[model samples]
Target: MREEPVKTKNANRLRDERRNQKDTRNGGEQTVLTEMDGIKNAISDVLEQLLNAEFKKFVWHLWNGVGADIERIPRAALENADRQDVVDRMVQKYTTNAGTVAVQVLLNINQNDLAKQLEVKLQKASSQRKGSALLITNIRFDKSSQRSGAEIDEENMEWLLGALGYSVEKHTNLSGEEINTAVSNFSKRYEHQCSDSTFVVIMSHGQRIQNKDAILGVHYDPNEHPDDIFFVEDIFSHLNSVSCPALIDKPKVILIQACRGDVCAFRDPTNGSFFINYIVDMFSTSAHKYDIMELFRKIASRMQNDPRFSQSKKLLPCIERTTLVKKFYLFPGLMK
Candidate 1:
């Protein structure tokens, strides 16, 4: 019988519920899709504008260096420009500057470019079959009665080093006299742990002598002669002996982060010379591009410019090596 349109009650309820759920899901999905498309378009436009602006700026800088008016160069010259042409011009300009041409190139290459180049060089060095090991040591002692401000945060130092890939062993509550003994014992116990491809980093405070030598991290009481200063060289010197064969022909990196004497210097507050901070920053940003020596030189330069370090009349870092070339060679070399 064609009775009242055979509407099954249960089927009608199920159909309504299914339609409502689908509509809800689709509405949410449409909102998300629209938001994502807008974001994508905005990012694409920004990137394109940035790239174009940089290219135009490069051209302008090149024109200025050559004593040519940028206005004279047609806008069409830069539109759809050849990247190779820009690079070639840069090389030519650099060479001209090198040859004592009095032209000042105004290329605004960022520090990031420098960092990338250094990373490439480091990667290349590391690839050349050099050994690779990580070393860390943290030594802390009571501040000398004479030195009221020289406090060592041994716990933080140890934690920081370990974070930087070092195996840390803590020597607690040791006196200056006990330091030497502890270091000696620790060295003997782990001498075999180091390989030719090892990397060693020592963190502590010390004095800078003649802006050439760095003394070890130790506190000397008033009236104690400067000779009482413990030099990092002493601790590292033990590793130099032929008897300790594990470290021979290896790359050792010693990082000292303490004031070298009370000779205060004016340093730039924005970029002061905190040795540990500099080390961490440099390694994190440019370690891939530069070898240890080059990286150290940059850090030293940064320290010099820092106003907070202006009082550092002659603070310098010391590197003693039997063979400078072999010792400073970074593993994996520079990357292409």
Candidate 2:
């Protein structure tokens, strides 16, 4: 009887040990699976939050006139929405706008199929008698002195203008009086030079005070006019229809690279100053006949939308006389 009882007890203990082992194994597997699920959920949540934040930032930047660097965004991110659909929507939006449609569609294209039918609009535009371009850059660090960048700016202007087939005559370090004299000489020379299509670009250090506008430069001659004088309106006014009938009705583009007032803060890094660079890049790559005003607007929009230049509100081309809404178009190469 004692042997029988011991045998039974051993059998029961063995069964209990086996059951405990199985339970322990199951518990460990459950714990691991639970931890993995939690980690997966947490990761998903973080990605969702990040994507939402970035999208909001992009929209905000675009609306504020600071252009977002679309290229910087990951392709996977943009894949959320069909890229073709997005582009189509953007085209529709731009084309439907009041002034945009008139200039982009009506003036440029007589019919809807015309622009699309052309294999190369740039070549076509180029074939229609090459026009002349003139670029002027004047950077005066102080009222009395001119910086090296001024000359560099002028040289860049000359090269770019020359490439565009303009007989460019660039001048640097000219005082206010000299500018007036140069303008007069330019007017006379310009009339004598290619009397067909012409373009003039002026880059300088300018300021807009209450009602008066001023362009600063160095005075070389003592007998010359004052260095810091108000001649902004006077200079441009000279290019009136009556003054230059040959240039009348022709596209006369003027670009001014200067500060509008002393209230601007130079807190942004130099790399952020991409206005001139962007213009150059666009000009070089542009294969179609682009409207100058439209180009300026696009540049302004890009600058205003970018986060790096969020603080800059005054960096825009001050256009007068011409209707920018009616005049701007990108050349064929730069368009698509």
Candidate 3:
């Protein structure tokens, strides 16, 4: 009798453990379902607010980005679908990423207000994240003339990086080799594991060597130390996937404020260089609402109209070596 009671107790414990495991599994699935429902509802709210013609345009734009992919919903499936049906299909096809896709499409249609609303709604569920940045400014050079008004540029950039929630690691007056070493060391920093994005802002006098962009170091001189220049391509290699796995799939924003041609940075006697001033102005005012790319576009547009960059002295800020795979918004003040 005693043996039989022991056996029965063992069997009961085993069955209870299995039941608990099953409940946990079901609970996870239920959480996913709840999240999907929330996305669908939020997306549907925007579609509901749209007029007939606008709704048609929205659908057309959505299909343009999503169609032709085997994993995406077929266009035929959405041809006659209502708002709720379209929402359901998007959620079903893209899962958690559906909200992001919807936001992109909304922005494409000039529905900025709706897109911002949707993004805010989705942001509540995102995990808290941090970022880091490297600001390397070579204001004074050995042979080349000093970067006039670069002090102001450095201050503005540092402030902007902080506002964007990045802990800035700044370096000044480093040689070509030292700059390379700084970047190499920064790439290996453990902070990257916890960071969602990073920035590498290098400001110096630059020249094109055999059609390759090269940023001159503080010790660079044409006659004395001609080789004291860091190639822009090296920066990419240091932070690329093969070298810095920690930053893989995360946004790596590299802003180079060096001239690609013979022209040097134009400085306002009081403020700073034209590039830095415009960047600080645009990002400070509109970063919370617009993504990085849009902010850059606004800056470019401003430059095009400004009296400073006349036909006589053309200074154009160019973006190069872009490897970003997704939209990056500063969302300033969120961390604060």
RMSD of each: 26.1, 29.0, 23.5
Cα lDDT of model 1 by residue, 125-176, tens digit: 2234333322333243344312211122233344334333345555433343
Instruction: Tell me the lDDT of model 1 at 37.
Output: 26
Every model's TM-score: 0.43, 0.50, 0.61
Please identify which of the two predictions, 2 or 3, would achieve the higher TM-score against the true structure.
3
Q: What CA RMSD would candidate 3 show?
A: 23.5
Model 1: ten consecutive residues of lowest lDDT? 1-10
Flag regions of model 3 displaced more than 4 Å. 1-129, 332-336
lDDT by residue (148-211, candidate 3, tens digit) is 6677778878876765567899999999999999999999999999888899999888888768
TM-score of predicted model 2? 0.50
Deviating ranges (above 4 Å) for candidate 1: 1-164, 190-194, 197-231, 259-273, 307-322, 327-336
lDDT of each: 0.40, 0.42, 0.72
lDDT of 1 at 85: 45
Q: Which residues of candidate 2, in runs, are more than 4 Å off?
A: 1-134, 139-148, 190-196, 220-227, 263-273, 287-290, 312-314, 323-336
Instruction: Determine the C-alpha RMSD for candidate 1 after optimal superposition of all C-alphas.
Output: 26.1
